[model samples]
Target: MEEQVNVPQIFATDPKLFRFLTKVIHDQGLTPGVEWKVCEGSSRGDNFIAVIKQVVHVAEGGTALNLLVKSAPRNAARRDAFGIREQFLNEIDVYEKAIPRLKSLVGFDLPVADLYGATSSHGEETILLADLKELGFCMADRRQGLSKEQCAAVLRALAQLHAASFALREGSPEEFAALAESVREMFWTQPRRHAFEPFMRNANKETLRLIREYYGSADCDNEYSRAFRQISDLGYDFLANIVTKVPENKKVLLHGDCWTNNLLFKTNDDGFVSAKLLDFQLARISAPMIDLIFFLFTSTKPKNVGNYLEEFLRVYYEEFERRLKTAGFTAAKLYPESELLADWIACVPYGLVVAGILAPALYCPDECLPNLESVKENSREAFVNEYGKVMRANTPESKEHLGQLVKLCVEREWLRILN
Candidate 1:
């Protein structure tokens, strides 16, 4: 006879969900006495995540298993409001379909959280996963970028991810196509575009204001100024079309949103030993540089970029090539270093746009954080209003970071590449 366990209210309120989660545990070969607790700092956006601690009592006392449960928010209105239901579905596809296929490649280890089970209906979704924290994973500070070693580790992980996609596409085209077709381009969805246009316009205006203040009208004829002017004037159109364009040859499955907040790192006495990518809600099929440039600009310090940008690029390229060859493909024939650099240079303007818009928010004081709820209610107006407040509250450090970014673009001749 087995003992009956009382599930806590955190997961017990819904009997169906409780039974589903219990089955998840049992399928993992765990006994049924389970306890649930809300994960600290896990309730955000459209999901609520909890940790399940299962203790099985037997003749030899007991054993324990800890798992994570992420589900749609209980509030029906809020869950329905943001119009991000498809994004959740896309994330589920990544974990349930994409990761498994990628992991099948020889010698490839997917640097993402392990999934136990996933379920969705209508606009609601739930995903149960192995708790990475239980495996000694911790997030890097969002305010501070990764150290050199940490950056290298992340780049290596990204290389494996990208290479695995290439291998899948070559070895199992049908399977790869099926998974890729399921990924939705959430960032470019009509509602998101409506919200993004006004935000881009405001960001362009602010970026130009800063540039003029720093370089003055006399310098407008210079190459850097001319490029900036052209890009800024195009504004929303440039952002909408060019930034989202997929490259013909160098395309791969992109992490899409690779900002610091979505990455977790594990460190030991030597330094960062491993990294895990998270938050696949924005995953898409696009140029690999889209992920590379986005991660470089948003998650790294200006000084770090200045010192090691090329080195970092090389690391990613080398590792990508290594994995490709290991999977029995010719990297040079498929994705040479020259092609990769050319793709990266062509994407610099996109990086500038993202950095410009994200800087103010990324650096805004805690008190000045935008009311995301209000933004969801009225995206265009609320975003523009919040953009003003963010720019007003921007710190000198952030301003300098933006300035350095532009300077680097000029020095690297990224503008020249565009022309």
Candidate 2:
């Protein structure tokens, strides 16, 4: 799947993909009277879950429209192990149902990519979206993480989204509950745990190993070891229950995966970095702290995190409060600043677990990324375990990512309860 796949080669391998792309174009009223071809849209490490390609269209006088189309996985092993179809359906459901409803409820436009159409027909699942690159946006270098300005931009965007979820929840409880029902918990569900358990256990073990290596004595029944062990021991139900069993007062739909790559940025006319959210595959109903903590750990410069962690909290809270206030709800009564901070402290373990999962995708350069589809292995567990081994090869970038987060957590006493 990582090989150089030309248009003809792609169509030859997956014949029906072309038809689906064409149908999306026709239905979306895009590239009227133009020929189109599928071409590479992103590099290998930029995206992993979907087969992404650009539907490049050109007319007689060179009028062009370049849109991005994401389809299902091509490999059966990857498809089944990752439950690509289920995630695709979840993502499509968010775009088709949740986004529009949220927009209407919030009375403002969210910063998501403009989706043209989505479909899950026969053997093909695809979503057509206007390309952000075509609109003067690009990804920051993952190794460096987002700058303070970029992070503030992302946090502000996240606040608006979390606020919108709160608005929907308060204004229409039944409707909000219905929307929550449609979002399938893609990551930590029972049926898919068989496939994800090996990955999770191995990932947790690797992180614990790194913790011991970094601090040299963080093992031996210490908090660091206990934290990762708790996650690995509890596994699926532990993680799933944190999300699916949320209290009514603590509920808000989370952008469950908010790693660096899932966000795109451009400097607006106001000369500030602004972000557009991407990837709803992991969208689920949960508290806002999960999203906030995950992004802060995995996507911000670790140095900035230790120094400006409270600043980040303030930025998000002020915006969240503003949005809630506008909707005739008092943020103090609904979710006070003290409670948000306390909840955020408690959610650090969740952040740590998810940040380990994000490390490979966040820090692995295109040159270092492996093609999971082509890996030779006996079963999903073996493949996932091997993948963890490869990803945790004592690479400086990833080790620093883990080390800095752990250090910050320790300094803040966020991991103290693990003991």
Candidate 3:
């Protein structure tokens, strides 16, 4: 039997927490005497990541270091607060298991802080990690989505990470399974299913309503219209398909949550490439294509839809094929590259619904928060003007491609609304 992993134990208890952080720094060749300061302008919540400023006490001079002090939200009134303690602990497992493996691929690609277990003076669990600001880093603002350069860097990093896993599984199945087991629940659990159900229902309703208002009765017979009306029902099916229908043997690690906000970017002085990545909290074992489609559709404008996406997937497959060959893993016949376009079509609708629901939340200003009243006033024309390509709606190619994607999901028996 595979080792029975205990999630809770992975987190350090109160008394042992400080020592863990100190030990992590020491192991990394930094001195033990360190100063800690919380990062400014961070959001607070139950189980939210807290940032801290740290300085290692050096013999010659203590240089400043920015550290992320990750903590679980301890809010009592929150209904969605179950198992938060386990969540933080799970994050530790993710960092410990994936980071080292990923390091070889990206060569310090991500601007994440060093994570060492730590506890507070009053007996609370904490994690000490790197600070983005200390490295002169800030995440790409979710308002504008990723710039072309940011997309390229992110895609390259993803390709490398995916390649590393392909290499591992191909070379040493035992080792790969062992690591995956440690963090498997990070992605697969349906703990929030109850809360998510209502959210998804509302999303589906809104999608159809929007479609009706925008297109009028003329295109009601269109496949795209039919698909939009049934997106929400498909979400549950998707969840079931990905989580249950797909056999365990076929699964690979996924980012689980691959939205742009979850990603961070580190850029050079002239705003060119440096490194980027963040929010490993949702890392899990799943199909890799989900991550790619999720990022491209939700985080990019329609103008960026085709060629760049094609190139990115090509690069991923190229890397995947190379690694598989190196490890003597010849499953090329099983997962043929020729099937990519078909898979892409199948996956695009999933991206569409996700992107539609998320576009408001990710891009909205605080003043335009998604209150019922605001939503009532927010017309489809405004939404399209803000994010969609007006030209895309008129173009024959865009319509056909977009319509085909929508049609497939509808035929697959997806529900009318999507969350």
Compared with the true structure, all predictions reach lDDT values of 0.70, 0.77, 0.53
lDDT of 1: 0.70
Tell me the tens digit of each residue's lDDT in model 3 across 87-148.
55556666776666655543333334565544432224466666665667666666565767
Candidate 3 Cα misplacement greater than 4 A, ranges: 1-37, 41-60, 101-114, 118-125, 184-192, 214-225, 247-250, 268-275, 318-336, 368-419
Each model's backbone clash number: 0, 0, 23
Residue 248 CA displacement from its true place in model 2, Å: 1.0
Across residues 43-93, which tens digit of lDDT does each residue of candidate 2 receive?
Answer: 766776787887776644666667788888665666765678888999999
Residue 43 error, candidate 1, Å: 8.3
Stronger candidate by lDDT (2 vs 3): 2
The candidate maximizing lDDT is 2
In model 1, which residue pairs have backbone atoms overlapping below 3 Å? none
Query: Please, what are the lDDT tens digits per residue for candidate 1 over residues 1-419?
Result: 76686676655667766777778877867666544444443412212122233222221125455566666644444444444467678889999888887887746778898888888776447777777877788777655667888888788888888888888887787877787789887655566776556657777677666655555553354444566667777666565555466654555788888877677788887764778898888898877788888888877887787799889999999999999988899878777888767877878888887887666656666676544444454443454454366666666556666777887888877776456
**What TM-score does model 2 achieve against the real structure?**
0.88
Answer with 2 or 3, whichever has the higher TM-score.
Answer: 2
True-structure RMSD, every candidate: 4.4, 4.6, 10.1
Off by over 4 Å in 2: 1-15, 28-38, 59-63, 217-240, 325-328, 365-367, 373-390
